[model samples]
Target chain A: MKSTTTWINSINNRFWRTIVNSTATGVESVAVFRIIMGIYLLFVTTPTYTWIADLPKALYTPPIISFVNLLASDFPGRNFLVTVDFLMVASIVGIVLGIYSRFATLAFVILKVSVLSFQYSFGKIDHDIMLPATLACMAFSGWGQTLALVPDKRSKWDSPSKSLSVIAVLIGFGYFSAGIEKAIHWLNFDLNSNGTARWFYLGLYNLQRQPILAPALKNAPFWFFKIMDVVGVIFELTPIIAVLISRKAWRIWLFFAAAFHLVNYLLFNINFIGNGLVYIAFINYKPVYRYVANLTKSYIAKALILAAVGYAAVIRGISILTSQNVGIIFIPDNGNANLYCMLIIWALICAALFITIFKTGKQPVHDDLEVVSPQLT
Target chain B: MHSLKFTGILFAIFLIPFVLRLFGLEPYPAILFPSGPETVKQVNGKTEIETKQLFAKKQNGQWALVEPKAFMYPVSAIQLAKLVSKNMGFKKQKPFPLKGKIGIVNYLYRSQNSSSSAAEEAELRNWIKKRLKRGNYQTSEVKVATYSNIISTTNGNILKKELKDEKYYNLD
Candidate 1:
């Protein structure tokens, strides 16, 4: 009887703890999601951006419509899709800045989904679907709960808390949805015994025909392709098992799925519905921040920030003086590089924030803040 | 200690799908083509032979072959377009017929008109006798030759006459 009571109390504690942490995470996510959407919109619409029309030509469907093909077609005002893409980007930025976030989130969801759907309207996969879903969740969840603009210490709605739970659930749904899609494709969907090899052969043939990567990927053999095909199938199917098992399992599943998506973006130059965005949505944000904070020694945090700032200054200075391109040690050209740059910049900013907090004698932000009601206190 | 281990496990779990994706498993959608018919017929006069058509139609839950008598091999659009362009003498080559799109052509097989006198005559007589049996046509005006598994039907078209195979026909 005593042990049962103890177990019940533990469960209750866990439930309440989760509520508080999720609330905080949800608030943080609004900022991140908004900024990301804005940047993406701006980047795609940039006049100097050249890759808009240079997608692999082999991706053409005989009976179905394709975005690239549509762009090349006699369709009127087709340029409006780019305008919508830029709007979504702007909306996300607006959302993150906590400036008219509700309206921004709604606009972002509508424009992003419509354009992506119309672009790949012949048919689209999970990546295309997930972005709109994320935006929809964000819109309803009151993601920007703790905004600098609002400056409200005591609020009734607990907006961020509600949003966090919704976001986490949606992110989980994205994985579950992908798993479901894979199950559909794999059920009695045997390409034949030698189908795997044939599939790889077709992929390689398609890759070799690509104007950009043709020279590099053309020489890869049938055996290499066969292995990749089988392995790819296994990766697609593994997530279904991963997300349901445990919290640890979900994290692993999400990480590898993100990496898998990243690799596809890099090697195959596929970018339609990217995996990274969906992966971010699935993450246990509070735990991740806590874990990273714990790993950084309180002493070295300042030095790390200084080093980063110094490195940035040196790179900037060298670029300005030489009038020659710096041979930076990094992934070059390709769409993948932009994502990598975003990740780096985000990490650097986070690190700077952490150092500032420590130096100013301010406590690291707690995963949960319990604001007692005036009447209770 | 437990939290650290949990964190490590979490990271590993996340990394697995990505690693699998990197090595070549994509979580993207599969693209497929529509089924079409098996047999195509080109009826010119009383002589009828099968012509190759592009797509097959799915009827009553079964895929019916479009050109039943004519064997179909998956041919690339570019190759078919080139063949048609060369024959038709188009100013510029057009894009090939797509998967669901069908292309129709009027094709004929030809036999030799040669100086190998006696042997050619014997071959033509044998050819005429075979077509008479298979086609069941009493018209002796149509001369037939069986060689290279091809049954040619010629009706005094010089273009058809110019193109000859291993078989022989009499100059009647």
Candidate 2:
């Protein structure tokens, strides 16, 4: 009787703790995520909704949620969409600057969903839902409490916010759903039903230009792709499990997730950079923020880095507006260019990880927050 | 009690969509990846994969190859191929009498019929017309053709590509 009571109590404790505990490091960590995500939205993801607006109206097919159609009686005109796009940029600037951050995030989400829904109405749905979802969650996360020009006194900077935990759960389930779909299709005993190879062939047949690694890997063994298919499904299905296990497990899962996206980009030319960036919410970003702060003690060095990023963002913005072909690093429309960009990104990530692990020695313990499991806490 | 309620709501938000999707209902927003080809077949003792390509007739009375990616900005090539081969058409239905606006609008439209709808044909014609105009060609007809991508089972080189079924759509 005593042992049974102990087990039940443990379960009860876990259930409540998992629900109530915050997964984030602090307000400063969320602030960093807001700034980085803002820059990514502004520069890397150039919405071609204005171009989409030009497509024939006969092709407009509403998504599963049809009420979106009622938002506008008729399909929006190009000028209207362009205005919305410009306002979206302005909102992103507000988010980055931490000026009325929640309002900016909310505005951005509304405008983004409006445009993306119209784009998807034409019969193709891109898996870019996470970005808007993350923005919505961050709107209420109290991220602006730390870095804002006018920070809210009500915002608790030291206490971990539950918003990150919510975002993590959303991402975990998103990938879990995708994994279930793949498992249903690819788990058959047939060896020839290699999902990766089939996607590669589809890319070759459909794309205007061949994927970068297609020439080299066209003749790769059938077994290799079959292995990749199995591994991909496993990676997708395990995120929720990782989340329930511990924070260390979740971080390790993220490392693999990054590699998965990079490989997918190289082989299939599919970009999931936005979804991958959302993974930052699950990480303990306090150490990373401190490291960056220590390195940028000098104002001149900080200004130089800021200027460079601003310049690149402007160049990317101009290229999108003018529809001109810039260098592969800027646009990365082709495979070779994508490969180089991926390599550079991976290198920088590795360098950051190395510095953080060695220089920081070990992560200091936080007594206030649970590490996704009771045992760890 | 409030914390428990919030946690319960969060769990429902994540799990409800997943459960709906599992039962083949997509009433909620979720991430979906394109499913690849179903199977690889053996033809004449060689491995074979099949895919579809799109072509548009030019003013010179020749069928020129059309890259769907060029005209269909965000649509995947596989999706375009499926759309072309299946000849799918959307049917606009009357809004159902439901309690909420969302529920009413949700049932307002669906894809119906194996045969092409006027809207589908018009959309295709527009794409073909735009593609041809870029190359300074005037044409009103497009073709959806299937090709067998044959590969060596021993070595991975593609041995040959053989064209199979051919379907044409004329806008004139």
Candidate 3:
């Protein structure tokens, strides 16, 4: 009995230790993640709910959420949706600036969900839960503890925060779930059950999303698609285990995951770039933050960078409002050339992240005795 | 104690959904994909697949093939199919103005708007017109149809297309 008890205690100790060590992040790291996510949401993932508002109410098939039916009964007006869009933008700005960031995050989450719920009510439910889930987790995290006008008082800046670890676990389990679903449905020993080829055909014929590689890969061998199906299932299934095992394992898995998304985009024109951006939570950004700080020590350099970001944001906002087809860099279109450009850009980003992870090595664990970074303090 | 409590909460949050999904109840935010059995099926020694297409009739009295993407804006082809099969008469369900009850309650009642069909039809026509206007064609009618095709199971090449159902709406 005593031996069993001791074994249980050891396992519990190991689990908690792993969680704490994996999530041992500096305040600057979390702050950098906040800024990066805020910018990504503002420019790349800005909700175009105005078009959804114009959809006929007859098509409103509310999701499982009961409150959505009530909302659909008195469907929101176009002006109301536009106002929600603007408020979402304002809250994103607040998140970037770290001014009442928790509140800003909460507001953004509420507004985003409200609008997206209505959008999904038109019988199309997109699996876009990651961004909102991340934002919800961030609202209660130490992301605003550093580089903030209003840092969260409840957060212990010097200690390891559970937020990043939680996010990593969430993403891992999400992939695991997908992997399991595929395994159940796609793992039959039949040669004809090739999920990858099926999706490729669907995109090519039914969806009219002819990416650059679609034509080339159309006549590819059945065995090639079978291999892809196996690899994809394995890739999705291993993330949770990798995260729990070691930081290096997690980084390696993430690189492969990014590659997987890129491959999906290449063949199927299905974009999961938002999910890729959410992987930023798993990175230790303190070194990057420090490098940028050192590079922009001059006041003029800082001002210039800020101006550039602001100008880009303003231009993106204008493009969205005017419904202009902002080039494929910002919005992916049906152009083959633009598809190639996006692929190259995404590949470079994945490579850079992989290099950064290897170069930085393991993040240091924070304990009561460890000295906090001066800049963070 | 704090770590234990936090770990417990996290486990609960993740595990509940995991367990629920195992039982086939997809609670909100469940990770799902639209992959399943092979679409190509062998029926009576013949391999075939089902396909859907949207077509528009121009003012020039010619029916031109319309891309499903042109008319199904802000919704997927699959979603449009569901809306058509369920709400529209495509699947033989009473066309709109459906009367139903909420749960097992005695007093709670629900009724679809009578104008819903007309409104939805009008919107679909507008979408068709907008898409055709880009190509400098004036659309006067639209049709949503499904086809069953004998296909090459090896390469997914269609051998022949047999129209299954064709629903037409006059824009005039």
Candidate 4:
């Protein structure tokens, strides 16, 4: 009887934490998330902005009306896209600067989703829906109250928004859905034999476009790809399991998630950097301020930041500047420098993260005056 | 606003399908996360062999496959416009729905262009045969069929059917 009561209490505690505990995010953390999102949006939308100008006028079926044939042409034209792009730029600037961040985030969502769904309406949809989904939640969540040019302590958005928890759940849900699909798929195939891997999994590698790695990946051993196939299914299923468990498991899962993105980027050109940045939604950013507080007092963090910045941006920039206007260019015009730029960016990200972890991973969260209704509390 | 209640509601949305699936009703509605058809198609050899990056250049409003090239450049704005227009028009026929009492009227409305689907299968076989003949090989039976799959989402997975085709030729 005592053991049964303990079990029930444990289950209840876990259930409560899963829903409410994850929702307690500080505004500073929310602002950082918003900033990261703003940066990611700029990078993601750049190619579409540069090339696919016709996406706005394409046949669009909103996810709701996708089932029926009511209105496929209820989308904006190129002129609207051009106007949206201007507004998007303005919004990103606002979000990053914390100047009217909420309104900016809302604007970005409307414009981005309008363009994205219309592009995918004609029998194509990529796994980039996290952007709109996350943004939708952000619009509702009171995440706009911190670290911006104009902070709101008492805005309705500051109330515990369902979006904060929803974003975390959705991340796990994506993996679980994929895992369930793949597991069922594996069950339907003759797993004892190698034929399944040859026919189904081999085609995934065919999408690779990396100049060097693309050709190499094609020649990689079939068994390697077979192992990778199994690993992919497992990796896809992991976030769901991790999210169900504790924050430690979720953080550990982020390693695999990062590696997954890295391999995909290196092997194939399918860069979903937006989803990677979205992982911030799952983590508690209370440690970030502590890391910064300790780091500024130390010379090592400052030196590392400067050196990384100088090597990544400055030296690369200098090389590009010096190589210009000459018949023989030292820097490859094929844009190989972008790879080094990526390396630098990742290096800085790692440094920032490591410093934060080292400085404040053990420190307790300093709570502010959190006032919600009894139901929310 | 109660965490338990919120989670309970979300779980309830997904629970019915999950419980039904556990009880062996696989077609139950997927609310939160769907077990999609993309994986299901690969089970029991259902995936179709389809060509991709299959671009056709437009000259005077006619579609012809662009010859095999070392690399595919990004399709231009004008080409993309034409591609979308062309994509919207190419509606292949649906297979006869899994039905019993729905009768011939529903079948007639649903199953148009089935002959074109057969023709498409034949054309795919011929394309394979011609390629094999070019390589100096005799051909045998060619297999052709349409298979089902899906593009999954959070709400549910929508079913999609596409044609899988192959041709057998002299090997020894």
Instruction: Please give, for residues A253-301, the per-residue lDDT of candidate 2 as tens digits.
Output: 7667777776776677776777766765555566567765565566796
- Model 1: lDDT of residue B139: 20
True-vs-predicted CA distance for residue A190, candidate 1, Å = 9.3
Model 3 lDDT per residue over B1-172, tens place:
1244566777777677667656643345444433343433334333555556666666676777765554554434455455544433211223332233435221111113223456556675565466567655566656767787675545546668899988776665
DockQ of prediction 3: 0.29
Q: Interface Cα RMSD for candidate 4?
A: 12.0
List the candidates ranked by DockQ, beginning with the highest. 2, 3, 4, 1
lDDT of each: 0.36, 0.61, 0.62, 0.46
What is the iRMS for every candidate structure?
Answer: 21.3, 5.3, 5.4, 12.0
Between candidates 1 and 3, the TM-score winner: 3
The complex in candidate 4 yields a DockQ of 0.09
**lDDT (10s digit) by residue, model 1, range A1-377:** 99996776666445433533432334444444444444343332221111122212211111122333323321123245445544654564465445566677788767654444333322222244555555665564444443323322334433443444444444444444344333444333232222233222223222221223433443444334334545555665565344334444545555555555544444454433333554454332443444433433355864663464345334433432332223222335343565666445434333433332233221223433223112110
The number of clashing residue pairs in model 4 is: 4
Per-residue lDDT of model 4, residues A1-377, tens digit only: 99996776667556545643434455555656775666555432333332233232222223322322223433445465556656666676666555677687788877776655455443234557666777767755555666555754455445433466566666766666556656665533343233323333323422213432545554554444446556777887776566556545555666567657666556654455666666555455655756644654577965764454333333323322332211112333333565654544444444443443333333222243133212243
> How much is the lDDT of residue B81 in candidate 2?
57
Per-candidate TM-score against the hidden true structure: 0.42, 0.79, 0.82, 0.60
Whole-model alpha-carbon lDDT for candidate 2: 0.61
Q: What is the lDDT of residue A198 in candidate 4?
A: 34
Q: What is the lDDT, from 0 to 100, of the residue B73 in candidate 4?
A: 21
- Clash pairs of candidate 3? none
Name the 10 consecutive residues with the lowest summed lDDT in model 2 chain B.
Answer: B106-115
- Where does model 1 exceed 4 Å of error? A1-26, A29-86, A121-127, A147-200, A207-231, A238-241, A282-377, B1-172
Better of 1 and 2 by TM-score: 2
The C-alpha stretches of model 4 lying farther than 4 A from their native spots are A1-13, A19-25, A47-75, A156-163, A187-208, A282-376, B1-5, B8-172
